[model samples]
Target: MLDIKFIRENVDLVKRVVKNKQLDISIVDSVLKIDEKKRKLIGEVEELRGLKNKYASEKNIEKGKETKLKLQELEPRLSEVEKEFLAAIYKIPNIVSSDTPIGKDESENKVIRSWGTPKEFKFTPKDHLELGTKLGIIDTELAGRVVGTRFTYLFGDAVLLQNSLYQFALEVLLKKGFIPVLPPLFINPDVYTKMARLSPETEIERYAIERDNQYLIGSAEHTLGPMHMGETLNEKALPLRYFAFTPAFRREAGSYGKDTKGILRQHQFDKLEMESFSTPEQGLVEQDFFVSIQEELMQALEIPYQVVAICTGDMGGPDFRQMDIESWMPGQGKYRETHTSDYMTDYQSRRLNTRVKTKNGVEFVHMNDATAFAMGRTIIAILENYQNEDGSINVPSVLQKWMGKSKIQTK
Candidate 1:
């Protein structure tokens, strides 16, 4: 949610942003009109309230009965009007950064830079699904028998590979002086709403216990960002860095055709999430640190990749600005989003009430999050980049110790 004052002062600018992003623009107009109605209603109601107070002190109490009765008739209507105004104000989005490029979708996204080339394959390379099935390491069919589509069971080497990725990612983040935390897989709807991650459209991708009013977390970020919700951290504790590991659930609604063949678009997957809380001056610096860690993690895995700044349309409503690190997938012959390092500034903090008390008595902390490693995508990068002519997969050196094996070959 944006500050109501900001929206009041900049309705036209807000209209331009959501319009360029292809969102419904009428929402902006609705907000402005409702706010106007609310202001007038408040003044009227306050006058009535003041009159009621005045009657309480009247020289002749019975003489004030007519005015009191009129106020009683207006009170309920005033209450309803105030409720409508607040609802409309909450619909407005945050102010977008001017540097964000205007575009309709990801295709219009600009590639800021690029890295290592896709390796030459002596033999046509197989995708992760083909390799997994051939090695009897991934069992999607049995997974279907047990839990239905969009779920899978990993065995032997595939299990090792996935576990290796998690262990390696956790170690890397820990070495960076980040505190590791494992949060509850199930979270209340209220907390989800506070995190600004709850959406009706995402229900299909999410596993929700509607009766319990709880949602399975879709990303460790959902927990990491709100960990300090409604709390005030000391300014001296400027940047509280945290690394989180958790299994994410999503219903993958409306994404029927893309990434359907493998774990790339699963209903459940694992990830290592990095988040931080900092002062306004410190948000970008924390973002830079997160980017450095992301680059290092990719380098450790020996994956070729590039970093690109997200356009205004691509930055979600809660993010002020974002940058993504796309790891090179040789088989796909393109870079895909592997990690996104973002600076949300006070976008999320305003809602979560996670603030810092500066020595100067200032408040409202800045919050930021980045994907340290989204397991399924990392595995895709691994298989595509390190496949052998004989159908073996080479474990990246950094993960070899954790994997306890150098290469994953069919038995």
Candidate 2:
């Protein structure tokens, strides 16, 4: 949702971004052409309206009737042209930051830094699935029968552990000046459209309730991002941070045979998400702050992880820049993505009509959303990293109090 003026002035840069992001370059040309027609029609409509007004003042019935006919024809044509122009413009993605890396996919993503060290196990480690099953904490077999694949029911300590993770994440964000919110799990199609900038491809990934005309939210950010839709906020409240926990549902379309065993890629999962609204100058800072918060959470958990700068092609259309925090999972013998931060600039705000009244006048607010914790994946990291040789799971010190025990073990 870039400003058309910016797109018009920085055509070359926009083209380069489209190329780097693997988007349709022809869309840029289409937008310009449609906009040209739209502008011309608008001018013609205005001129005809003016003539109609003059004819009325002069009491010229014949001229007035002709002008009225011209206005009716031009107005509808202008409306059609305007619709085409808007559709074309929406197809254009936001310009990437100058510093954003140019690459085709995740393989080229740059790891800016890493924290902690991968643990060395003297004995073979079992994945979360095995550990949970042995400890009678996770039941996937029953869930498969009840809800189909990629679903699981946590029993006993696993339930406590997941809830503890939620509490811990909420506390961390609350201390950082973020207001906690519990948004509706179901959102109207209109709000979701603006929040996600729904294109045909993305629309397929959502779970739509056809009868209700609502879609299930895929993340807390989905709802949080549109909280101020079509509103103008006071600049004095520059940065409004919200932390939310929600049960997100997704169709998981096109993602088959990947992490299907565990809760990593589930049709339904819980997540703690952070969303913020800030002035343009503060967007990047807010992004960095979110990454810092992520790092802090990872460090507190004492898990090995890395911070990656997402390449152009790997980023979402609305993301100006993005980063992912991948935590080590010993059972999987690799690092798995646990959190992501997307700096959308004004891409989302423009569609949401979320603006702020600043000294310079009203302007679209820069929006950012990041995962504080994906509960299921975070639990996977915890289960794999904190497992003892004897099949007991040692709770992270920070969560021990909430769990009321230091270890989860079978009786």
Candidate 3:
């Protein structure tokens, strides 16, 4: 949610964001009208309270009773208007950063840089599903029967490989001064809404535990971001960095018939996510560092990848600026998204009420969250990129120590 003052002063700019990001233009008008009503009601209520206090001080019982009656009538109206104002304001999306490319959808996204080269294979490469099935490590057919489509079971070396990826990413993040965390998998809808992860457009993609009124998180960042909600921190702790590994759930509601053959798009997947709170001056730089770290991880795995600048339409509503890393998938003969970095500035912090006390004054902290590894997708990249002519998968050298072997093959 944006500050109402900012919206009022920059109505045209906000409307431009709505148009560029493909949101309803009328939302701005609706919010401003409701804001005006709410402010008027607040002024009335305050004036009545002052009158009531003055009567009490003067011992004017008859006048005090009349003032109290007016106060009762106006207070409830003010409360109702406040709620209406909040609902309307929440619909306004964050302002887009000047550097973000204005475009429509993913196809318009620009590829800024690329690393490594796609390896030439002696034999025809197989997709991760085929390779994992042949190696007897993935059992999606049974998973489908037991739990429905878009679920899978990992056995033997596949499980080991997943753990190795988790540990490898954790070590790298730890070296970068990030504290490790294990966050709750479930979040209350109210907090989730404040984080801007829950909205009508995204409701279909989320899993709601209606009985408990909690929603299953789609990313660790969802839980990690609100750790300091409604709190103030010292400026010296300006950039508090944390990372978490969690099993994320998604409905894949609108993604019918897409990546349906493999774990590439699953209802349940594991991920390592990095989140940080920084002073406004350091926000964009923090995002740059995150993307650099993502590139470092991919390069260490010796996988080919490209860095993409996510266009306006393709970026998240809360993201002021965004970038993604797409890894080469040889079997698919193209690059697929494996990681993303979002610099939200103060958009999320403003809603979460996570503030920082600066030397000059208090202000909302800028927030950044990025994918350290989307385990399933990264695993797919590794399998497709490192497959052997004889159906073996060579473990990335960095993960080999934890995997305890250089290659994964049928026993």
Best-matching candidate per TM-score: 3
* TM-score (all chains, Cα) for each model: 0.91, 0.98, 0.98
Q: lDDT of each model, Cα atoms only?
A: 0.80, 0.90, 0.93
Model 1 agreement with the true structure over 1-411: per-residue lDDT tens digits: 677777778878888877766678898888778778877877877887787778778754774686678777777877887677655655555666666667777776677776666677888877777777777877889999999888988889877887888888777777777898988888887777667677553456667898988989988888888888889999887789898888988888768878777777888888888889999889878888998888888888878898887876667766777889998776667778989887888877887888788866857898889998888888878987898877789999998998898999987
Positional deviation of residue 58's Cα in model 2 after best superposition, in angstroms: 1.8
Worst 10 residues of 1 by lDDT: 86-95
Q: What does candidate 2's lDDT look like per residue over 119-159, in tens digits?
A: 99999999999999999988889999998998889889988
Clashes of 2: 0
**What tens digits encode model 3's per-residue C-alpha lDDT throughout 1-411?**
899999999999999998888888999999999999988888888898999999999999999999999988989888888888888888888888887889989998989999998999888999999999999988899999999999999999999999999989988998989999999999999999999999888899999999999999999999999999999988898799999999999999999999899899999999999999999998999999999999999999999999999888888888899999999999999999999999999998998999999876999999999999999999899999999988899999999999999999988
Candidate 1 TM-score to native: 0.91
State the local distance difference test value for candidate 2.
0.90
Scanning candidate 3 in windows of ten residues, the lowest lDDT window is 90-99
Candidate 3 lDDT at 9 equals 96
- Residue pairs clashing in model 3 are none
